[model samples]
Target: MNKVKVLLAEDEASLGMIVKESLESRDFVVFHAENGEKAYEVYQTEKPDILVLDVMMPLKDGFTLAKEIRLENKHIPIIFLTAKSQTSDVLEGFNNGGNDYLKKPFSMEELIVRIKSLLNRIELKPNIENIKIGNYTFNFTKQTLIHSSEIVQLTHREAELLFYLVEKKNEVLDRTFILNKLWGNDDFFNARSMDVFISKLRKKLRNDDTIQIMNVRGFGYKLLC
Candidate 1:
């Protein structure tokens, strides 16, 4: 079996070494960089399977590096490591094409689990047909939404959320259920992140008047088409 390659971009020297050693002990090939600029350089050469980037780094921040990487590769899983817990920061990470987020002071075991989860998600390829939503056609596999020759590229989380909404169209999807299903926890931060994605999907589908993602007070969301 080929060892999974992980690009870890963290400015803090001690933390970087600890994370590198921890992942290596678990059989992962970790390419550790102390700054985002060097991380980007390593990324281009090594073509890592996944990226673990710290939000605060010299030369290039994690979000900036992620945006640059997204221009070249849309499907590679990227996870942000940040100390900030604000909703806006979470939203920003997703906007920059991150597939997941892990707050700082996270357990090594938790980080490992998240990495494996994302990698496993990438490996699973289900033959799902294109789904229609009002004036748009959603290609889950392609991570795109198309309408009248306009194609809107979706991040991995956006695609997943939209697919779930499509699956439960015309019915209320409990907020707790969605949080658990996608984020693995229904905590405050994850809940805020879910809301951010919801807002984004609403904007993406705004072209069609017939499509609505209505929030059910005290419940979840319902996709009306």
Candidate 2:
């Protein structure tokens, strides 16, 4: 079996080496980068299964790197390592697309535990297929929504949002719950992003009059069919 791959970016050479060796010992394939710029380059090239990023680094920063990654792949888990333990800093990490945040001096064991938990959660997500939503067929694997012979290709985030809504059709989804599950945070930035995706999905599904995604004021949304 192939080991889980990690892209680790840390400017501190000694600490980076230690982390690389520790994860390697646990049968993880680690790609270590000494700066944020190199980390992004390696990420595009290697396409690691997960990312471990230090907050402060040369070239680019962890938050910036994470934001860029999220734009391309919303599902990839990102763990941010920061020396700052302030609540504001933690919030910043989440707002910038971190799945989890670990303050400096974190235990290696704890990091491994978090990684395993994230992977398990992702793996256990329901792999829905060929779901019928009103007049359209949603193919989750292909990320496509088909109506008769016309097909609309959806971005990964759009497909994920639509999938969750369809799974809970007719139920009012809590905004915070959906935000946390989908964007890894319920921060303002992510909330806006979710709203955008919701609007786009609504427009796409407009052709099907029987299907509706209703907004529950001050709450969340409900997909009615």
Candidate 3:
């Protein structure tokens, strides 16, 4: 079996070494970079399976790097490491295409778990045929939504959430269930992230006025078509 590839970008020398060695011990192929610029260079060359990035770095910040990467590859999972724990900071990470976030002073175990969880979430499955949603054609395998001549590419998490909504259709998909299923946790950060994705999906599907992703008070969401 091929080993999982991880691109770890951290400016702290000791901490970077520890993370690289620890992931390596778990049979992962880790490519370490000391700054954001180097990390982007390594990312282009190595094509890592996932990226663990530090928020504050020299040359370029983690959020900037993630945005740059997202322009090219929307499906790759990105996890951000930062000392800031404010709600705005967390939301900023997600806005920049980060799939997960870890506050500073975290355990190696928690880091590993988050990495594994994100990897698991992005595992590929057999391609399925496209499904219709109002005026849109949703291609699960392609992770895209088509409307007339326009095509909107979706990230892995967005695609997963849309698929789940399509499966349930008009029913209210519980918030807790959606969180656990997609993020592997219903924590505050993940919950807020879920809301972000939901808002994004709403915008993508706005072309068809008849198709709506309704927010159910205290319940969850309902996709009405």
The C-alpha lDDT values of all candidates are 0.90, 0.85, 0.89
After TM-score superposition, what is the CA distance of residue 100 in candidate 3 from its true location, in Å?
1.3
Q: Could you give candidate 3's per-residue lDDT for residues 66-173 as a string of tens digits?
A: 999988987788999999988778778776778788889989898999888888766744465479999999997777999999999876568778988998999999
Q: Estimate each model's TM-score.
A: 0.89, 0.62, 0.85
lDDT of 2 by residue, 6-82 (tens): 99999999999999999999999999999999999999999999999999998999999998997787678889999
Residue 46 local lDDT, model 2: 98
Better of 2 and 3 by lDDT: 3
Q: For candidate 2, give the lDDT of residue 219.
A: 92
Residue pair clashes in candidate 3: none
List candidate 3 segments past 4 Å from native.
124-129, 139-144, 150-157
RMSD of 3: 2.5
Count of backbone clashes for each model?
0, 0, 0
C-alpha RMSD between model 2 and the true structure: 5.8
The lDDT, on a scale of 0 to 1, for candidate 1 is 0.90
